[model samples]
Target: MQQGAEYSLDDHGADGTRLVLSGHLTLASIGPFDRAVKAIDGPIHAIDLAGVEEIDTVGAWVVCRAAHRLSSEITGASPEALRLLASVQDIDVDGPMRPPRPPVWERVPLAVGDKVFGARSGIYGVVAFFGQILIGAGSLIRHPRRFPIKALVHQMELVGVTALPIIGLMSFLIGIVIAQQGSVQLEQFGAESLTVNLVGRITLRELGVLMTAIMVAGRSGSAFAAQLGTMRLTEEIDAMRTIGISPVEVLVIPRIVAATFMMVLLGFYASLMAIIGGAVVGDLTLGIPFWTFLARIQEVVPEHDLWVGLIKAPVFGLIVALAGCYHGLQVRGNSEEVGRRTTMAVVSAIFAVIVLDAFFAVFFTEIGWG
Candidate 1:
C-alpha cells in the first residue's frame, strides 16, 4: 500500500561498500545517489541496483560507474558486476525505485526577471565587459604588428562599401516621398517653390544621416555581435588569450575603426542620393528643375548641416560597435547565445543611435545649427 521506497547503503566485504537503491531512479534520485557514490573512498565500491525497482539512463550510469570502479579495485567483481550494473534496464531490474519529482522550473530562472541586473550585478557585468576588452587591448599591445590587415580591409569594405547601394537607394526613395508629400501640400498654397526648403531641412536636420546610421547599426551591429558571440561561445576568445593576444586592439579596435569609417561614408552617400531624389521629385512636381532644386538646397542647408551629419556618423558608429561588442561579450553558451546577442546588438544599437541623435538634435538646435 505504501508508495514510497527506501534505498540502503551497506558494507558487504571488509574492503567493499554497497548501495542498495530502491525507488524510481528519476532526476531527483540521480543527485543524491551520485553524491553518495562520490563520498566513497579507496576504490572498493559496489552498488546494488537489485533494490532499484525502476531505472533510467542517468541512474544506470551511476550504478554502472560504481560497479566498474569497484571491479577495478576489488578484483573479480569487474566483468560480472559491471555487466549486471550496465544491464539494470527497466525490464531486468528486480524492484522499481520510485521518487516523487517536480518540474525543474523551481531550480531555474525562467524569464527576464530571473536575469539580475542590480547595482552590484551591473558593476560586476561592466567589470567583466571591460576585462574582456582589456584582454583584447592587451593582445593588441603585445603583438603590435600582428594586425590582420586583410580581415580589417574585408570587414570595412563589406560593412561600408557594399552598404552604399542600399543606403543610397533607401535614402533616395525616402527623399522622393518627402518631396512628393511637400509638393502636394505646398502646391495648394502656391508654395510649390518651397519643395527644396522642405527636402533640405528634413534631410539636413534629421532624415539623411540618422536613417543611414540606423541602417548601418542594424546591419553592422548585428553582424559584429553574431560573429564575436559565435567566437566567444566556441572558446576562441580563450584561445586568443592563451596565445597572449589582446582582443581589444585586435578585435574591437579594428571593428570600431571600420564601422566608424563605413558609417561616415554611408552617411555621405545617403545624403547625396537623398538630395538627388528630392531634386527629381522637385523637377516633376514643382517644375523647378534638378539644378534649381539643388541650388536651393545648397542655399538653404549650410555647410554646417553637412558637418552635423558627418559628425553624427562617427558617434553612431561608436554606439554600434560598443553595443555589438558588449552584447557579444554577454554571450555564454552555444548558438542560442549568438542569436540572443545578435538581437541585443541590433536593438541596443538602434536605441543608442536614436539617443545620440536626440542629443545631437538638441545640441545643434541650441547652437543655431538647425
Candidate 2:
C-alpha cells in the first residue's frame, strides 16, 4: 500500500516561504500534490523533502520543476531522491523550440552560395563518372567476350527503329512549315524559287540533326533514366553487383553504343524525310514539280552541310545517353526520385545539345565549313 503525496507551505516573514512535502512522492501519489504546489505563489526559499518516504523519476521531475520556477533550494532529500532529482535536472533542456529566421539579405547570399557549391560538386561528379565510363570501355575492349551484344541490339531497336515514325512525321511537318514560310518571305523579293535553297541548307546543316537529338533526348534518354532509377529503387542494381556484374557495362555502355550507332542513320533519315516534305509542299503551292524540287536540293545544298549534320549526330547521341545514365544512377530514396531524375535527364540532354550546337556552329563557320 502507498501513501498519497501531500505538501504544506510555511512563511517565515523576512526569510521567504518554504514548501514542506511528505508521503510517497511517486507517480501513483503525486497528482494532487503537484496541483497544490503549482497553486502556491510568492517567493520560495527552500523545498524540504525530509518527510518524503520514497521518490521516483516523475516525482523528482515535479519537485525539480517547482524548485526551478520558484528559485528555491532543495533540502532534506534522501540520497536516492537527490540522485533522481539530479538526473531529471540534467536531462531537462532549456531553450526556444524553433530557431529564428535569417533576414532576406542573408538568405539570398546563402542560397547563391549553396547553388554555386552544388554546381561545382555536380561538375566534379560528372568528370568522375566520365572517367569511370572510359575505364569500363577499356575493360570491355580488352575482353570482347564480356560485351553486352544483346542489350546493345535491343537498345538500338528501342532508341532508333521504334522512334522512326514520330521522327519522320515531325521532320515532315517542320519541312512543310519552313518551305511555306520561306516561300512567303522570298516571294516579296521575287525569289520564290529560292525556297529549295533555304529548306535544303537549313534542314541538312542544322535542323535535321538538332531536332532528331531533341527527340531522342526526350524519348530514349527519359526511358534510360526511368529504367535505371526503378532498378536502383528496387535494389536490382545492388543485386547485380553482389552477383559480380558491372552495371555500367551491362546497362550504360549498351545504351551509349546503341544511341551513338543509330543517330547517324536517324539523322540522315530525318533529313531525307524533311526534304521530301518540302518537295511535296513546293509541288502543291509553289508551282515547282516534286521531282524538280528534289533535284534542286541536291544541286543547291553543299556537300559540307550533310557532313556537318552527320558529324554532330553521334556526339549528340553520346551526350543524351550519358545524361540519362548519369541521372539514373544518381536516383535514390523513392519512386518520386525516379520521375525527378528522368525529367532531369531529358532537360539536361536537350540543354547540352543546344549549347553544343551553338559551339559547333561557331567552329564550323570559323573553319570555312559554314
Best by TM-score: 2
Q: State TM-scores per candidate.
A: 0.66, 0.74
Tens-digit lDDT track of model 2 for 204-264: 9999999999999999999999999999999999999999999999999999999998999
> How would you encode candidate 1's per-residue C-alpha lDDT over 1-370 as one tens digit per residue?
3223355656666655655667665556578667766676655455555555665556556565565655632222334444554465324233347765556775455444456535568568768877876676666678768767777798899788888888889999999998999888988998888888888877865788899878887888888898888889888888988997656666777887788888888887888888899999878766788898888888877788889988988888878888887788778867987898799789978997898899998999999987
RMSD of 2: 8.1
Q: Top lDDT: which candidate number? A: 2
RMSD (Å) of each candidate, 1 decimal: 12.4, 8.1
Native-vs-model 2 lDDT? 0.94
Q: For each candidate, what is the lDDT? A: 0.75, 0.94
Off by over 4 Å in 2: 1-100
